[model samples]
Target chain A: MTTVLIVDDQPLQRYGFRMLLDSVPGTEVVGEAAHGAEAVRMAAQMRPDVVLMDVRMPGMDGIEATRRIVAAGDRSRVLVLTTFDIDEYVYAALRAGASGFLLKDARPEELLAGIRAVAAGDAVIAPTLTRRLLQEFARLVPPAADGSAQDSRLASLTEREREILVAIGKGWSNSEIAGHFVLAESTVKTHVGRVLSKIEARDRIQAVIFAYDHGLARPHAG
Target chain B: MTTVLIVDDQPLQRYGFRMLLDSVPGTEVVGEAAHGAEAVRMAAQMRPDVVLMDVRMPGMDGIEATRRIVAAGDRSRVLVLTTFDIDEYVYAALRAGASGFLLKDARPEELLAGIRAVAAGDAVIAPTLTRRLLQEFARLVPPAADGSAQDSRLASLTEREREILVAIGKGWSNSEIAGHFVLAESTVKTHVGRVLSKIEARDRIQAVIFAYDHGLARPHAG
Candidate 1:
């Protein structure tokens, strides 16, 4: 069963969640908190598999609570719920390490699905929403400090490795990159390994991140 | 009725799409193209509501075709269809001005829904997928050039103005910012105005982008 901690400032809201959760198989509510501070404390003790977080609270909002819970190094994944579809709370929650979020008015099935998706280490939000948010933020990012200068970290990579990094940053899997670039999967893997090491990235995810940070890859650019 | 142009290298695939689309009540396949070049030409001439673009093709690829079509300033919106889910093609397609994308293996209902969404100027990908893609890219973003040094563009802003900018970058709506900062909405608007003017941003979106570029706001941070 997936143990969940429901965090909300309203008793009615908490009750509604509990009632709905009780009906679902393979899921249980371990506890509930009215605000961020208590939520953080309860999370530490319960070690729930998922936390249903409310963004707005009387004191210590959901964002702070999420940051603390994730920072505490527990295995509890956060699934933030907000009244608004697109807002700072949702964005901040994601940045705070939330697995994803759902609208408060989401259908019961969607809510349950979101919870399960978060518990399974999958993001709760759809990929399109993530893209728009990133595009909006990416537009504000200042040009690299070095201006037109190539990132020094990239100097070590061969042309093929550099290409792999760009593809990875664009969220391409190894097989996709290989197929698109006409390289064997083994060759792609070798290139990916070399690219990861040269860029000092921990894994494919980090490599993608590095490519964006260094301006080697961008979303929605011509 | 929503008019669509099918662009695929394979005749059988185009035929399948045509058969399905012709049977749909609200959608009509206006034209078909065996390659990106033909698709662009047909898009310009047919002025269809949507273009069902296949990413991989001989000669100029879908990304290039999308960029050119969008750059042409036509009313036709491109909706890229790919066999792969997470890949560079989707990213490039979005950048190239495709409204969004759908995987080829998507259910018929899902494909129809995606087409409708794209035609309506809505994104086809899920927001969660977009978020994950962005987060992955954000991780790779290089640290700010001057970690502690004040950005030159931010010199003119009042302390409150800077705070508002950061909030905007975090995707906070004005009311949310006002509530969190204990400021009136009118005052927040004024501050936003000053921030935008001082930074020479065209709008809120640009300001958010600027904040990320200047290292004022981050994707994942404690």
Candidate 2:
């Protein structure tokens, strides 16, 4: 069972969440906090799989609590709740290391699905907010930090590896890259491993970011 | 009714999509194109509400078609389809201004929902891709370009408007901001409108991006 700690300023809100969670099969509301400090404390103590955070809490709002809990290096992943569909607090909370946020009025199934997604180490964003997030993402994503294709880190990659890096940046899976390049999946994996090492990237996701940060991958015309 | 243009190189793929969309209520298949060039031509001529695009077309690829169609500024919104979940082509398509993407293997309902969402002017990304997207988003977002607190655009704001801008950046709803600042909601709305006009932001989303870019809103410690 996935354990959760509910943190909201309103006692009735807490009760409502607790009641719904208790009725669910896979989720268990392990504890409840009416403020951020208490939420943080209980999170540290209980180490629940998911923390149902309320963003507008009175003492030390949910964003702060999420940052601390995440920074503390515990197993808890935060799922912040906000009253509005597109709130800046949600963005702050996400950047502050909350796994995701949902509207407080999110349907019971959506909230539970969000908890499951976060508990499983995946991230979630409410659907209503995603379009704007993406638009900002496309807008704010800077061109390669060095506009020229001469970043020293990229120098280490062989021509083929560079292509692999670009493919990774494009969010292609190893198998897809393999098929596209006519390489065996094992060979593709080896190349991916080498590219990650050469680029000093922690994982494929970081490699994708690295490719975009450098000039290897770009939003090119068709 | 939502009119759609199906663009895929493969005959069977086009047939499948046409059948699915045709079978659904509230959706009408206006046309079909076998390649990017044809897709672009058809999109220009028909101006369908949504374009179901395939990325790996034989001649003119979906990404290019998406770019051209979006650049054409018609009412058509492109929803790209790929065989893989996290392809770079999808990212390129989004940057090129496609509305969103989905796996070619997505359930019929999912595809229909995506089409509806795209037609409505919202964006969509497969749920599986959102986690990685958000993670990279958090990582790649640059700190304030100026880093100092002295951007001229920001200088135009009054003290309260600056505070409102920061709150907007933090994703706070006007009501939430009002609650925190103990101001009337209408007063907060007026402040928000003023802030948006002063900063030359198109909407609240852009205001959030501006706030982050200007360092008005930060991921602060609790």
Candidate 3:
């Protein structure tokens, strides 16, 4: 059974969530918390697979509490559940290491789906929020550098290699990149490995960020 | 003198920008283009330090042209000049690797600042767009399981080290982390180093991506 915890300021809301979650097969509500502090404590103690968190809490609000709990090495995935979907607090919660973002008003299945998704390691972002986020992101330019960053680090890559790097930065894997470029998977891997070495990047994520920070890749794709 | 090329369709607009940028010290308009394709060729041939690009052009729109120019590895930094701040085109421009974003109606001085900032390697994005982008990004959840992705590899680090990894994902460096936990800078460094090695990450950037991929860091920080 997937163990879960409900953390909110209102007991009734917590009860409501518990009833919904407990009905799912092989899932159980192991504990509940009326505030962020208690949520952190119970998450640490029970090690539930998921923690349903309310964004606004008394003292250590959800963001800080999430940061602390994650810092303390609690393995449970924290899904920030709230009435508001597009607040800065939700953004802050992600920074604090939240695993999922779900609105309280979502249908019952979506809520349970978010829990399951987070538990399974898949991201669950409200779809209505994704495109808007990417659009706004297009407006945040990286630190510019009179053009040296490109020549010094990224431009050093061969033209073909740069193509692979851009695709990776867009969240495509090596196999997918091979399909796009009509190259061998092994060749794609070779280029990716070379990208990591030449740019001195550790993995695809850094390559992705490097593309953003250096202005080689934009988070929004056409 | 810093030379510039204005690439927009409107003559009056070009005349207005020329008046503004031309007034700045070490800046001048060397060329102008009314179409995206023309802008690409002009930028490549002119070798101007900056290309003030308009996103919507009759053919070969700004984003695609930006991609070709950037891919050609030219010296000009494309500062996207657009009427809409959060249009989908902006994201395309970013992915194609434009250096800056500027609203067409920004104050003359603000526009000059954008040119100078991009010319200096410091990026400029509108503030309102930045907030919305981060909210959109907060919903990303890490993949649940990949037989070969970074998550399984993260299992090698000590719990303390993982905490440090999560902190780095939040963009915290050694000193800030040290201050947070009351640990010495050296201790934080050691932890970071160990974390990097155990996870087989190439460097801090990889560690940061690993953190984000594991559902740890915010996509963009305001």
Candidate 4:
């Protein structure tokens, strides 16, 4: 069974999630905490595969707890639960080492799947949070103090492969890209698959962020 | 002068827009059409740079007019105007050769900018329409004939670049990504900038879409 932990400031939320996870097969609510401190402790003790965390918990808020949880070396994957307004903190939480974050009102199916996905070592983010995430990235992009080390991560690409990477960052489909590059559809397909494998991305969404985070892609002006 | 045409069933809308265009420098209100057929005819004759077409007009709606305008070898850009309820048809209009679509209630300044942006060959998707567009893109992505093409978009990346791209697609800030990649802040910035230039992406938002469109990116599970 996939063991899970519940971390939130509210009892109602904890109970509700506990019930939901209880209903799903292959998942069990092994522990619950009412705040970040307790969560950090329980995470270490329970050793759950997943932890559903809330953002506004008092005393070492979610971000702090998330940092603690991950830093404590517990194997548990954290999944942040939030409402739309927590827009400001979502980016910070990811940096704190929580594997993923999503809105509180996400449907039951989505929540359950998220737990499973993160447990399997993938990251997640809510759609409503997309704009906030964009703003954060934009605000932080200009002062990039992190130059000089020449990210060896990008050293693996060839020239044409880089061209296709930009196209992927532009949101083009294989067929549309085929037209843009004047290449056959099959060729574009080969390039895309190889690129993903080369980078070991969890998915395309991650690749997109990688492009932005590492400056492989810039925000398109409307 | 950037000659313009207004096409709408209502005379007031046509008149109002004509007056607006007349007030703008380098833009002239050259002709008006009460319906799509007339708009097509007048457009064929006047060959304006911009066409303000209403979506709900009778017989031969703005969509058909836009298609014909594109087919006729005219370089004129079509801009569709509609209500929120009628917004469903805007994407089709885009496919029909419309450079942009605006809401009737959009601020006056937005309307003017839409015109200039389209005339400049920039694709303008309304900010409010982003959710709707993504929903459409996600729904439409399923029937794509190229089943594995999504993964192929990143085929050219090195393993580390792919990891970096994934973080970028998630909308992470440079510091956060730098933390993840264990690189100096300057190094992260260079990688991100390189990713942007290499991918030919205009901005981070476009990079986000590119991630989703290619299936490399996805809605976070929880």
On lDDT, the leading prediction is 2
Error of 1 at B197 (Å): 31
The docking category that best describes candidate 2 is incorrect
Task: Give the winner by TM-score.
Answer: 2
lDDT of 4 by residue, A1-222 (tens): 889999988999899999999998999999999999999899989889998999887787887888788888878888988875564465556656677778898989879867887787756555445434433332333212222233455558778877887787666778888999999999998988877777666455455555555546553321
Clashes of each: 31, 9, 12, 58
Per-residue lDDT of B70-105 in model 1, one digit per residue for the tens? Answer: 778887888888887655565566656677777788
iRMS, model 4 (angstroms): 17.7
Of all true interface contacts, what fraction is found in model 1?
0.02
Model 1, DockQ value? 0.06
C-alpha positional error of residue B127 in candidate 2 after TM-score superposition, expressed in Å: 1.8
Off by over 4 Å in 1: A23-27, A85-87, A126-131, A137-222, B19-25, B126-131, B137-222
lDDT of 3: 0.72
Number of the predicted model whose DockQ against the real structure is largest? 2
Candidate 2 local lDDT, residue B95? 70
